[model samples]
Each structure stands twice: as C-alpha cells, then as structure tokens.
Target: MDPRILDLFCFWLLLSSLLRLCSAISSASDHRYALGDLVPFYANKVGPFQNPSETYRYFDLPFCPPAHVTEKREDLGEILNGDRLVHAKYELNFRQDKPLQSLCKKTLSVEDVRIFRDAVRKDYYFQMYYDDLPVWGSVGEVVDSSGRVHDRRYFLYTCVHFEILYNEDRVIEIGVATNGETIDITEDKDVVVEFKYSVKWKETNKTFERRMDKYLQQSFLPQHVEIHWFSIMNSCVTVLLLTGFLTTILIRVLKNDFIKYSCDEEIADDFDESGWKYIHGDVFRFPPFKSLFCAVLGSGTQLFMLSIFIFMLAIIGVFYPYNRGALYSALVIIYVLTSGIAGYSAASFYKQMDGVYWVGNLILTGGLFCVPLFLTFCFLNTVAIGYKSTAALPFGTILMILLIWMLVTSPLLFLGGIAGRNSTADFQAPCRTNKFPREIPQLAWYRQTAPQMILAGFLPFSAIYIELYYIFASIWGHKVYTIYSILFIVFMILVISTAFVTIAFTYFQLSAEDHEWWWRSVLCGGSTGVFIFGYCFHYFFARSDMSGFMQTSFFFGYMTCVCYGFFLMLGTIGFKASLLFVRHMYQSIKCE
Candidate 1:
C-alpha cells in the first residue's frame, strides 16, 4: 500500500476510538447522576434555594418562604409561582423563587440590561432554598458577544451544594456543582455570566427537562407506598377493635338497662343498677373550671373547621406545591376568621353553664390558646435570629401578624361573645342536680383517671402515629409529604378513635359511680396529644439528626404549642361525644 493509504487507515482508527471514548464518558456521566447515587433521605426531597439579602432592624436573619415547608414539602405552584421562569429578570417577588440559569446563556438588549441591572441592584446574588437549605447564586453581567456593541449584557447563574468540615473551626467547602459554567463572559468580544449550582444531591438520574411533556406531572414518588399502607392499616385495626368493643357494650348493657329503667321496674334481679343510673343528679352539675372548658371548646371548634377547609381545598388540588405561599396565607387568614366561631362556642357554653362575667370569659377564651402560641413562636424566632436561620420572622412580619390578630380576630370574637350572651337559649340539662354535690365512690385500678387516660390515648395515637413519622421527616429531615388525601383519612380516623375511646372511658367512670366525668372525658381524648408530644421528644432524642439551638428551640417550642392545641381540640371532641352519650343514656329511661 502507498504512504497515503496507510495514513488514511490510521486516521480512521483514531477517530473511531475518540468517538467511542466520548460516548462511554457521556453514558457514565448520565448514570452517575441517577437517583440511586444519592442518599435515600435526600434523593426524594427538593428545596428552594432562597435569597438571604434582607437585613432586618432587630437582627440579620432570613425568613422561610413556605410555612408548611418544615411541616410538609407540598408542591407550592398554586400558592406561589408554579410556572418555570424563562430568561427574564422581572420577577423578584418575595414568594417567587430566585431566577437561575440563562436560557442558552442569554444576551440582553439595552432595555433588558437596564431592567436586569435594576433587579440585580435590588437583589443580586439571589438566594434559594433547596435540600432544606439556603444557597446563594450570583448574577453576572456580560457584554455583547458580537463585535458590534449594541449596549447589551450577557450573564450566567447556577446553584451549588456545600459541605462543612468541622474541626477546631468550621471550614466551608463547596462540593458538587449545579451545571455552573466555567467560562467567564464579563469581558469584551462576547460576555457571559455563569451561575453556580450545588452538588449536594447525591444523584439526579435525569435532567428534569430531559423529557418535556405538555401535561405537568408533580413529583409524587411511590417509594412511600408501603409505609403509607402500614400506617392506614394500623389505624383501621385500631378502629375495628374499638368498634367491636363498643358494639358489644351497646348490645349487652344498653338493651337491658333501657328496658328495665324505661319501664320504671329497676327491681329486676338480672339487671344490675351499678352504672350511670346512680349519677343522674350529678351528671347535670356544671363541671369545675368551666371557663377553661368553654375556651378549649371554642378554640377547638375553630381549629377543627379550619383544618377541614384547608384539607378540603388541598385535596381539591387548589393549594398546589409550587404556590406554597398561598397555603400559609390561607392558614393565617382562616385562623383569624375562625375567631368568631371560637368566641361564640366559648361564650355560649360559658353562659349555659350558669357562668357570668362574660368579659373575663371572653378574654380567657382567646388568650388561653393564643398566648402560648405567640410566646413559643417568639422564643423560636429569637433563637432563629441568633443562628441566622431563615425561620426567623422580621419585626415587620411580626407587626403584620399582630395587626391581623388584633384587627380581625378581636372584633369577631367580641361580636360572637355579645351574640352568645344575649341569646335566649337556656341550659337544657335533662336531670336536675342536687343542692349539695354527691360524693364519688372508690374506683378500680383500671378505671382510675391515669390508667384510663393512657389506655384511651394509645388507640387514637395509633391512627396518626405512622403518619407522624413522615411528617417529622418532611419537617426535620429532607422528605416531602404531599399525601393530603391520606392525611384527611387519618384525621377522620383519629377523631373517631378519640371520640370512641373517651366515650368508653366515660362509661367505665359512670359504672364506677364516679360523677366527675367532665374533666376526665377531656383528659381521655387529649391524652393522645401527650403521646404525640412524647413522640416529639423521642424524635428529637433519637430519630432526628437536627442540631443547634435554633433548630432545637424551633422544634420543641412550636411543637409544644401544637401539642397544647391538639389537646384542646381532641379533648373538646371527646367531651362533646361523651355529653351526647350521657344524654342519650338518660333520655332512654323514664325518670322516676
């Protein structure tokens, strides 16, 4: 063969090897970014990297965008901006995510340049919250790439995942990068700005836009399917057990009692009159701490209704995850609006209990729940301020919240109180109370307050205990929980469990000839929150990897208030259920 032929053959072989190498490298890179490569905890969770440019008067701390972000990482598109921002810099809203990455390394005209510069001056080095973190992404200014200067700007933006090496001192190190460009485009000839990205995610199997579809698909991974069922089934079993026991009691006891008592022939040898019949007079007596009872009921009713509406809207797909701010706003507005219900429920009940001093009652009703919540929030916010965490609310935000509380809630509550006070409805107790209080008899160990409360609470907790795990993970760990439908079911089941369990306890207390069932009924259902708080303690001690005073204070403080609210709500439900039960029992028999 001639020299030319030999050279051509060598060139062909070399080109073939180069092509194969490039192909292999590309395939490996794709596999490297697969979901499997990431830690299971982080692979499923995504957070928005927020801008931390704001400097508040009191302290320098950023505020979290999605209030439910720490609770459940739902898609916020409906509440915030759901649409992905294109190569535009106009959107700098507090709720909207910081703009990132130029489409094809965009070149802005003179007008675009001025607008972008203004945006940058306002909020440059845009911040985002992602992977349960706040990351900084810088904005770059690039001149025209073409030789002809058209008064243009060029730039790039990116996200980055960082790691801290804590020795004697904490050393911040930037790790994996998020598609940031290496080329600097600030100079002449052609200017470009490259944004940096975080490499914190262990793996990202596919480029999100790798396959674009017209229909938007929310990220609802099926990994938690098994755990979800386990939770649901566990709750179902508890309900089944409760139903079985209650059914048997209803059949065996109520049938016999109703017949003998209604006929006014209690001397029947087979029918035992050892139960609620003994407490007819005392059953109608007003309970101790009636003021607190009314308050709890009022607030509980408000919370229950608020939860229902929010969950309903969420299930209907109104509060989409991308627009998470709407959910927070909804919660704030709803909570304020519900004050009327709380006030009416509290005041009317107080009046019915033969209580006067409507002013004191009204004040206590609102203050009881709100005071603790506000205090806890303040403490947590203070901690956040010290740590420079985004959870801190600035003074302005605090003022706005306080104003909303004072302006909207205060008036509603006052009107509700007046409405309740002036109402013609009187106390409708079925049985007349004795002039003197009746003494309660000795109770069995299992029928004691503590034992009954513990037993009653366990059943209700089972309904939500599994769901709690995912909730904690979403809030404390990097997990997203958008299963609103399942949450609704669990909530209903929990309410049922609490009601039934309290009723069961009331029956036993009545059987033991103890007439102090009012507080016990509340305690019986509210004890579930004690168990929830216990689990919170356990979560902090064992399950969670959270550290630092900011996180610690925020978790424990807010959760304590949550537990308190839960206690109020569940306890109220239990009391209502037991009241109905007691009334039904007495109504069935003709009073002698």
Candidate 2:
C-alpha cells in the first residue's frame, strides 16, 4: 500500500473516532422511543380476501374469512416498536383456504388468547402496547388488562392475525398457551380492553435501511385542507405573476425592438446603444471548463427527467405514503437505470462544445455526483454505526450498493458515452468570433454576480418555499406527505420560475455589455439551491428540535445531495434557456 494512502486512511479513522467521542460527550444523545407515538401495524394478507380468484400483491391486505371457517397461517414475523418510520410491517402469509375454526378444542385456561404466528428473529423484537407504553409481549398475551378501547370502537387498534397451516391440512387447532400465565376475560367481561401491536419488518435476511424520509418517518399529519391549498396557491400565484410581467415586457418592448431593427435602418443605430449585437459571437462561444459543465448539464438533465417521471408515478399512485421505503428504493433503481441518459447528455454536450477528451468527460461525469454521494453516505453510516443506531447500513448492504454501481451503472454509462460521441450538433450563431477577446465594460451593482444571483434565485425559491417546508418536515420532522399531485404542480411552477429568472438575468448581463454569461447563467439559476441549503441550515436551528450527531449527520448528508442535484437541474435549465433566448433575439436581427 502507498504510504500516503495508508496515512490518509489512518487520519480518517482518527477523525471518525474524534467525531464519535464528541457525539458521546454532547448533551443530546437520547435514543429513547417517545411515549404516545402511534404504532402502525400491517394487516395480514391472504389469498384475495375480497376476490379469491386474484393473486395477492404486497399491498393487498387480506380480510377475515366467514365465521366458522378454519384457516392455517404462517407468520410474517412479530411487530416491533421503532423510531419514526424506520420500521416496516411484514405480510403474514397463510396457507390457501385456511380459516379460523368457529369452535376449536377447548382449553383449560381461563381465557384463550389468539397467538399471532411468529418464530422470532433478532432484528426487531415484538412490541405490544399496554397503557400505550411498549412491552415485549408475544402473541399469546392477546388481551392485556390495559384499557384504551371504548364501546364506540372508532379505531380498530390491533394487528389482524392469520391462522397458520401445518404441512398436512390437518384440523389442528390454532391454540397458543400464554408462555405460562393466562388473562381471564371473565374478570373484566364488561370492560373494554384495547391492545396494540406494531410491526418493524424487513424481507427475509434483509437489514433495515439506515435513513428514511423525515416526513414519512411518522404516520401522522396535523395538516388541514386549507393549508394544502395555501401552499399550492401561493406558489401558483408567484409563478403566474412573474410570468405575466416577463410576458408583458417581452411583448411590449422586444416586439418594437424586433420591428425597428428589421425594417428601419436609422433606428438600428439605437440597437447598437448597448451593443448586445457586439458580443453575439462570444455569447455563443463554447463555455470554458467544458468537462465539468457537461457533467453538470448531463446529470441535471437526467435528474430533471427522472423527477418528472417519478412524480408521474406518484401521481398515478405507484408510491404510497406508508409503503416503507418504496419511494427511495424506486429512486435508486431509476438513477441506476438512467445512467445512460446522464452519459449521453454529458458526452453530446461536450462534443457540441468542440471539446476533445471524451474519456475524461465521461469519467468526470460519472464521478462528479456519485463520488460525493458515496462519501456522504459513508460518513453518515459511520456516525450511525458509532452511535449504535439501527439507521446504519451493514457492510454487506454497502458492498451490494457498490456492486450495483460498478457492474450495472458503469457499463450503461460507457455505452451512452460512445453513442453520444458519434452524434453531432451544429452551433448556429448570427455572428462569428474574432481573433481577439472582447473587452467587457463595467456594469451597475444589481447586474453584478452576487446581486444577480440573489435576485435570480429569489423568485424561484419563493415559488417552492411553502412546498419545500413540507418536504423538509417530511424528511426531518415527523410528518406524512402523500400529496403527489400538488407536488408535481409546484415542481412545474418552480421550473418555469427558474427559467424566466435566468433569462431575465442573462438579458440584463448582455444589456450591461458583460459577455461572461456562461457561468453567470449557471450561478444565477442554480443559486436557488444555495438558498435551499441556507433555509435547511436555518431549519436546523430555528424550525427543528432534532439533536444528536447521528441525526445531524444523516440530515445534512442527504441535504447536500438534494441541494447539489437542485443546482444541476436549475443550472442546466438556465443555461439552455439562455442559449435559446440569445438565439431568438440575436438571430432575428441582421447582426451578421
């Protein structure tokens, strides 16, 4: 091993140790499950409770068979108490045509408790609720003496169990002795008894996912219908108003400029006032830092398309709110599947820029985002492991993720890069570049990079601000967000807001005789992500009460990716919009 590499690893280990020590010493390392938290359970799924003809899907919850029918069942593991939405419910699979008997062999016990089928494993211990507090009671302790039930029965508060089967269709009774003791229902025959069971399940041998969306971490929401409307209408109005103003400016001002420049020669002198015509060539010249730009543009394009499709799936009811990490799993699968799109966009854009070194561009495009994601994941996982939290991915899962990236995604990217390199696009500009670079003149304060970025990002950020709050709360706080339709609408508005803001900023820059619009266009539109990160930082302190290093690391680690992806998506939108904006305006005139 290289000495420097070894040293670096040693240093990383030391840093990790220090961080864990600091987390331990910090005052906020509590990991206790809060009382009164709602314990969600999964209903046992059997062969088509409604229509016995149809096969069972994971989402299908089986209903109870008719009274007096006997059914044998298998356990989907016992339910357990967990933090947030960190746990999942396994479906209790029962033998076909099995039903609980109307009358079974009588027991000598005072009360016969239905033992929910489960042969326990160590991942999640069964958590039964007594007086709304979690206890490690098994299936036989069915009717605990605690009373949270009433005669009204507004909520059916217990997990539905299935009657399991033996190898033979024997008429064996579904009876479970209560370990040793029994609860006599006769003592409280008239009393209402409420019992609860929560499931924290996983696929057989599959471990728990380390981090889950905060909004989905719980199954509770305090939102009213009016608040949903408020979030949607606020964003819609912001986008509509900005769009209206831009439309008016374009129609009234640009219409006359186009007419005058096209027909009248004398008024054409005024067209040279700011000389947007002077740097038409430079404006369209290939942007510098070609590889990085292509990478950003490519990744952004893929994400843009992926987001639209994902939301479409959500709108169509593919991702349910309590579907237990289905959304995240789908996203990972999509990103891997879309690797080719990213590669194509990067290579094609780079080639169009007249950039050589296609291999370098491809490598950069692959690593630019993926590497950061891996590093952040490792950091968070390390923290989770240090804190002994269930939110840490085991070594096997991490290795599996790496294998997927390397074996599956990498080859797709290479194929895409090869295909895109063979494709060609011509750059159409009204003017030609001169041998010497144009000397740009100084501009007003608002036209400067900082001011332009702030203003350009402001409107777009405002458009999604309300939705963003909900999204963050869902990811970090205990909130359940299932409004996919509204989310899709807000996202479209945000895209429009970003494009218009970038186009406006680009126009101002060109008007000021500043030809540095390449990076400016990117920064202006991408700054919305910066503001988002800023808001997240503020939320960490102002809006959120989350504490502990493990939580903090997990929060920020994912936030970084979200912010970066946003930057790419919006920056690509701005860059492309500016190109079209310049082409439409300059090409309309006889600048050549």
Candidate 3:
C-alpha cells in the first residue's frame, strides 16, 4: 500500500471532521437558549374551524376505499373521541346569503356533530374548547347518581352551555365563532359562523400580539411559496454542476489511461510453488461485471439526485416533519424514476468489461424496477388500506409506473445491450502482469476482509452520524423543519463519505493484488451500507422516542433507501476508481 495514499486519507478524515465541527459550532452560536432549552415549547390551541366546507371526507381520502359516511361508525383506532360526543347532537346552520342573525333557526342531526368531530380530529390538535376558544384542560371526577365517579371534561370557559344543531340537512356545513359571543338569531342572515382561537408562538417570549387585520393580510400573501421555488431551482443547479464536474473527470481519466491489470507474471517468480498457476484465469475472472456496474452507476446518480431533492425540499419546507409521508414518497419516486440512469450506467460498465448477453441485460434492467415495487407493497399495503395512506400508488398509478419502465427504460436498456455487445473495449491488465512485480503488501486489521474495509469507510462517516440520526428522528417523531443547516451537513457527509470510501477501497484492493478491478469496486463500495445498518440498529435501541408503528416504518423504510443508495454509490465509486487504477497499472507496466 502507498503510505502517501493512506496518510492523505487520514488527513482528509481529520479535515472533514474539523469542518463539520466548525459548522456545528457556527450553528450553535445562533441558538437562543441553553442545551435543555433548545427543545421547542409548543403552544396548544383549540379551534379555528377555519373553513369546514373544503375539509376532506372519508371517500376523498387518499388510498382509502371508496365509502360514504352517514351515521358515523367509530372504529376504535380511527376515531379520536367516541363516548364524549352526545349522540344525535344539536347542529346550527347559517347561509352566507342570509344574515347570521336571521338564519339562526336551523335544526341539527348526528351528521353535523360527526363533521365537527372529524374536522377537529383531522386538522387540529387542541383537546379542549369553550364557545370555540381553546383553553388549558384538566381532568376532574364527577359523581353520578349511582355514586360512581366518572371522568369529567373541565375547561376554563365564560359560556354556560353550548348547543350544536343542523338545519336544511345540508351535506356540508361551515361555521364561525368570535370571542365568547352568543348569536342574536332572528335578524340578519349573511354572517357566516366562525370560531377563533388565538395562539402565541411558544418560542417567542414577548407578550406582543399582532393585530388581527395585519395577521389576516399577511397570511394571504404566498411569499413562502416563492421561496420554495427558488430553493428547488438552486438545488437543481447544484446537481448539474456536480454532475458536470464528475463527467469531465471521468472522461479525462479514461482518455489518459486505458489498461487493466489482473496479476503480474513476474510476481509469480516470488511464489513458493509454481502450482499457483491454477489461480490465473480464475484470478481476474471475477463476478459478472454488468451487475456491479449497474448497481454503482445507478446508485451514484440516485444519491446525487436524492440529496439535491431532499435538501431542496428541506429548504422549501416540503420535507419538513409535518409533511406526512413526503420523505418516503420522495425516496420511492426517485428510485422509480432513475431506472433509465441505472440501466444506462450498468450497460456502459458491461461494455467496458467486454461482456456480452443482450437478453441477460434486458432481464436484469427490468428486475431492478420490479424489486423495489414488490418490497414497497409488502411494507405499505396495510397502511394504504388503513389510512388509505392516500399516497400509495393507486392501481392506475402503479400501472403507469410499470408502463413507463417497460416502454421507456426497457428500450434504452435494449439499446445499451446492443451498444455494449457491439462495442470493442481494450484490456490493459497484461501490462501490469509484465511489469516488475512489486511485493504484495499485507493489510492491517482494518482493510483485509470485505466487512472490515466497509467498517473502515464508516469512520469518517460516523462523525456526522449524530446529525443524520437527528434528521431521521425528526422525521419519525414529527418535528418541525427549522433545522435546515443540519440537513445540509447531512447531504455533504453522504456525498463526501461515499467518494472517500470508494477511493479508499479501490486503493486497498489494488494493494492486496485483488486486481479483478470491477467486482472489487462493488464489494468495497457496497460495504458502507453495512455500517449504516449498524448505526440504524444502534438508533433502534438507543431511541425509545418513537411510536411502535412509526419505529417499524422508519426502520424499514429508511433501511430500504440507505441500502439502495449505499450499494449504488459504492458501485459507482468502485467502478470508476477500479477503472482508473487498472488504467494506471497498465500504462506504467506495458512494454513498448
């Protein structure tokens, strides 16, 4: 092994660690509180009942079975509060056309109560309300005539009794309420009913409150939307820049060196027994090069694109914790859409390896598309049925996904197959075989086996593992999106670590005389996921913070993407590095 390469690697790790530490320190300087105080204090609010007409119903819910609700049947887990509601509850109706005071004579049914319950449960988190004002609540005991104590709902309220009823038997109803006000029914009819609850930002310590007019005016402007658009555009530009740089490097390196080396014939003289000749043809006869190429190239592109998408969305508030399923959806969609990139990468590598078999290439390309979809169904089918997780692909959507893969990706893969089969690739390995055989060096405890080398790659990577864990935790635990800096750090770590590990592994493989360069790339490159899985396992036991269901989903869903991305990145790094090493070895040793 070159001491220079190893020292350079050690220095790289140190520098990366220092940069990350500096970034963390800079972020901490902006903090407003002590370590314990950094956790956000949330202000609980009750009702806005903001706009009831546009509320989502069961039938329209994503991924839900088409069903109509009449008399609401409470599924124990599905409905939040069951026994608290008074059955056949009172309802009131008002017409925007008629003044609220004039149209107050409306009767109510079970349906109106159901609508109110669903709206409150689905949209808001407040547990207590009085005449529509949110209040802090306490549990108290009330004695029934039977002399048994029952739970009573106690909330601070100015109103004595609240009645709800429905009028005109409308399918949907909207209402509003103002601060502790009772309607004087029987005069005007145009006033829409509204309920208002004022909340303060828990983080803001001051008592100042914005005027209602100003708040309303500010909320209507979509300034945040424009910010999100700009963030995505910036991310796309970054990806293009990185891609162009990598492309230029790849092309230049390929042009400069072209030979691949397996074993030096001169080195054979150093062996104790000439019987070692049995290890010749089989020496460089590594696994199918196409598979390795496909995995790496596909993954590199996927990682690059995914990091851009995630960070961009993070910047835009789309990947924020509250956006349920957005992260998972992003991951699934990226992989599905990147099939073309994967097929093309795999095909190119296979061509470089001088491998043939168009039928095999076609089958392999199609399989990558099907595998993830199958796994997704295994994990999400139940959730899809339960929440109608509305995000899961509908039948039509799934069919469309398959059609795109078949029609669009499959053809490109076929073309790649033809190109790969017909293409002539030169092997530069015999040059290394003829060159003065340098003594094969021994690896330390770290770089010998596939597992050890993989773990070694995780050394620099785990320095930022804390931030990664926090990001994953926030996603699982439903935290807000305020921690954008941490996300960017995570993005940088994944990219840098992938590149470093690939370079390191290629160096190690070359040192160990395992010059079956292409397959070695996949092995060393794919090893990073093993370390990621280890970290995930540690998180599983260490963090007792997530719900069982969420924990399960996060673990599997996260593992799926991590493993997929790790292998993909490894393959890419491994292949390119291996190609470069082979070329370097060949150019150095080839006879004139």
Error of 1 at 458 (Å): 0.3
- Tell me model 3's lDDT, rounded to 2 decimals: 0.41
lDDT of 1 at 31: 19
Task: Give the C-alpha lDDT of model 2.
Answer: 0.59
**If scored against the real structure, what TM-score would every candidate get?**
0.68, 0.66, 0.51
Best by lDDT: 1
Q: Best TM-score goes to which candidate? A: 1
lDDT tens digits, residue span 1-592, model 1: 8744553454354345333332312112221122222311111111121222122211011211222222223222211221111121222221123234232333434444453453333333443332222233334434456766555544433333343211111111212333344333233333333333222212223333222111122223476777888889899999999988888778888887777666535465456655678778788888888888888888888888888877876786554433324555556666776788888898899999888877888888889889998888777677657745445665766775676566567777878888887873888877888889888877678888899989999989978988898777755544555678988999999999999999988988887789888899989989998999999989888886555455567678878888988898999999999999989888777654
Runs with alpha carbons beyond 4 Å of true place in candidate 3: 1-296, 299-337, 386-393, 415-424, 427-447, 480-490, 516-518, 549-554, 589-592
Per-residue CA lDDT of model 3 for 393-433, tens digit only, reads: 34654565465455544554555555644553644344324
104-207, model 2: which lDDT tens digit per residue? 12232212221111111111123222111122323232233456433211111133232322222211112211243222332312323333222222223211
> Candidate 1's error at 372, in angstroms?
0.3
Local distance difference test, candidate 1: 0.62
For each candidate, the alpha-carbon lDDT, in order, equals 0.62, 0.59, 0.41
Which portions of model 2 miss their true places by more than 4 Å? 1-223, 263-273
TM value for model 3 = 0.51
As for lDDT, the candidate ahead, 2 or 3, is 2
